[model samples]
Target: MSEIALEARNLYKVFGRNPAQAVKRLKAGETRDDVLDVGTAAVIDASFAVQRGEIFVIMGLSGSGKSTIIRMLNGLHDITDGEVTIGGDPITGIPRGRLREIRRDRVSMVFQHFALLPHRTVADNVAYPLELRGVAKADRRARAEEILAMVGLAGWGDKLPSELSGGMQQRVGIARALAADTDILLMDEAFSALDPLIRREMQEQLVELQAKLQKTIVFITHDLNEAMFLGDRIAVMRDGRIVQIGTPEDILTDPANDYVEQFVQDVDRARVLTAGNVMERPRPYVPDTGGPRAALRQMKDAYSSAAYVTDRDRKLMGIVTDRDAVKLVRKGENSLRSILKPVPQSVSQDETLMNLFVPAVESPLPLAVTDEHDRLVGVIPRVTLLAALGPGPNATEEITLPMPPLPHAEIDAALGGAESAHEASANEVPTIKAPANEGEVR
Candidate 1:
């Protein structure tokens, strides 16, 4: 199957009698303002593709046409120009019956309001779509029960919408969409109506559910933070037009224009940047050659006091310091095993920088970055981490440092002080600060 699950091309939505003419004007290099006399352009020449199992968010403030673009995807709003396709099948200009079938079997939508039927049981509300398709009551009811459990409302199937809390009610809304068993999901402000705490919880729940379900989602929102937290890629819309589309880090570090720059100026960079974004190629690693002399030479070549020890397959074994390597050499040790020290800390490639502050500070050497199989992929030096945290146009720029050596005494003292401070306030989060001296190893 192709990777693209949904796509929109040159899409335009106009709300007036002469929408077709307005689109012509737009196509003729005339601005949206030029076509204002003909019709109101809701979405203008918006184009993007949503990969399978990806969360593609459309974000903009009110009247930016984000909502209109989403409606066009599933044929809720007629396209004034361009096309929309789901799973390689065009839905635009299709017969209403065929579109209905597509919506029933391949796409489902969840709205901002719970939209549950007030008089029906939660299970019935969820099973309504299946019921419309003439599914046997017993089968649809069972399916509803199963989906309810997946959304964390297992035993609440018997309760009415009126009897449930607002958050729980929204879960039913999601349950209903999932019960449809569609590969594509369109969520329009789905969590915007909940309380602040409840909204955050729902956002987290959606991410967890997406992991298990792997549904291709088109999430519409006005909140930049939500977009950063949830979207695999985001399309930023302005008045009736898409201005930029990129990953959260791309949007943050390289805004396309002043409008986008202003939008991301207040975003918390720590949460958006992951280890993979800032990590550099791992260097000066000894390939478990079983020789302390080899380890020392590698350290010296990299201008460092320490180096990682990895097996032939690049699976990280441990680290070796120059001092330890020298001791092993003097003691006539042939193997690096005696001198190997367990890496002080390691982080997965996807770990956010916010969670790495303490680990980066505690490590004597650059923090190891590993993949699922524990193979060393890269390293995150303290200097690089500090650079990423600093404010400037180059805040997110990658920095490469020659692995400079730190004296064993200084390394021990820094680690000891960090560990002590960490133990003193286990509940408080540590903040990032620049070192007093640029030459000092972070």
Candidate 2:
């Protein structure tokens, strides 16, 4: 097997009464007849592995055992059966001292409540972890300040936890998690408790932090949007079992079963799949400014897909993939300056991956993403629409991302350079790899 960041094999967690007896009963083929008579099963025979630096999500409705699974990984709760490992060390049988060391040194968790010290300042709550580990107050505070700045709580260091809003308090929680400097981060509905706008903001900040930190994260949530938005691969759970695990697109388009289908029925799929997501390797193409012979050479190279046409500015103008190339050559039009489509349906960097389809289904050629000035960002294959849609969501998914304001001017420029000259927004580099590749897909 690959060297996973974390792994769970035949992991089983049961709550209330004699859990071992419950397991024995379960093994003996006893079934719970009713909710009142039978004890609840928080997690049942769950198994999956997480690769290093990957964001793995466990999602489902309330009481599905997502939280239990997270707790089991961190040693907060014991498993009734099976093994759980972090960086290859089995968590189940470790000594208490060693487990303490592991929790202090390897894993850090953020709860939805943002458990800060109400009496202490933002800086104190962050420093508390390091201090408990016996670091000097000065050293701990220094590290706390660093994390605060990282989580955008720079000036709020002196403010009491009670003084801050829910979003700000959650930020402190995140900063505290980073203070431990652990390889893995465990989030349990970290943003679900906040208001809509605040929750959106926190998710965006988390994305920004993840981009820079790349910590192996196992986040749990009941929100389908958060699961879809932040997960590298989502594990959809139902009644203490993982039903499916794959990229958001995979789960969305090719649902594992009926349960997954109802989950993504209404998602705006184009936003999830972008031209940037489905682009193949770029082949050399004749510039529109190039002469006729160069265009012919380019045409023959393409098996059939339309060849993208660009100007000296690399602004997309037209395509001559496959048959278009043959027809253009037959017409004796040798210059790209003539055959290119002057107007095409294109998306900008600021747009969501869900919009990648408008041009794909409408345009003869594959859709291309352009920058504010109409500079071709990339080409997305039409087939990617299928790839983005993925299997139909049979289970609920979550969406989480940093909240950045849309750039009206940049979008205007992409539509056609119709706006006044102004500063264009800088593209926020993706912190995590998109589902398909490490780079921005759309």
Point out the worst 10-residue segment of candidate 2 by lDDT: 423-432
Model 2: residue 3 alpha-carbon error in angstroms = 3.7
The 0-to-1 C-alpha lDDT of every candidate, in the order given, reads 0.84, 0.71
Lowest lDDT block of 10, candidate 1: 427-436
For 99-124, candidate 1 gives per-residue lDDT tens digits of 99999999999999988899999999
Which residues of candidate 2, in runs, are more than 4 Å off?
A: 28-38, 268-271, 276-307, 310-352, 355-366, 369-442
Per-residue alpha-carbon lDDT of candidate 2 for residues 176-286, written as tens digits (9 for 90 to 100)? 999988999999999998999989888888888899988999999988778777888999988778889998768876899998889767765654544555554333344
Superposing every Cα of model 2 onto the true structure, what RMSD results? Answer: 12.4
Query: Each model's TM-score?
Result: 0.86, 0.71
Q: Largest lDDT belongs to which candidate?
A: 1
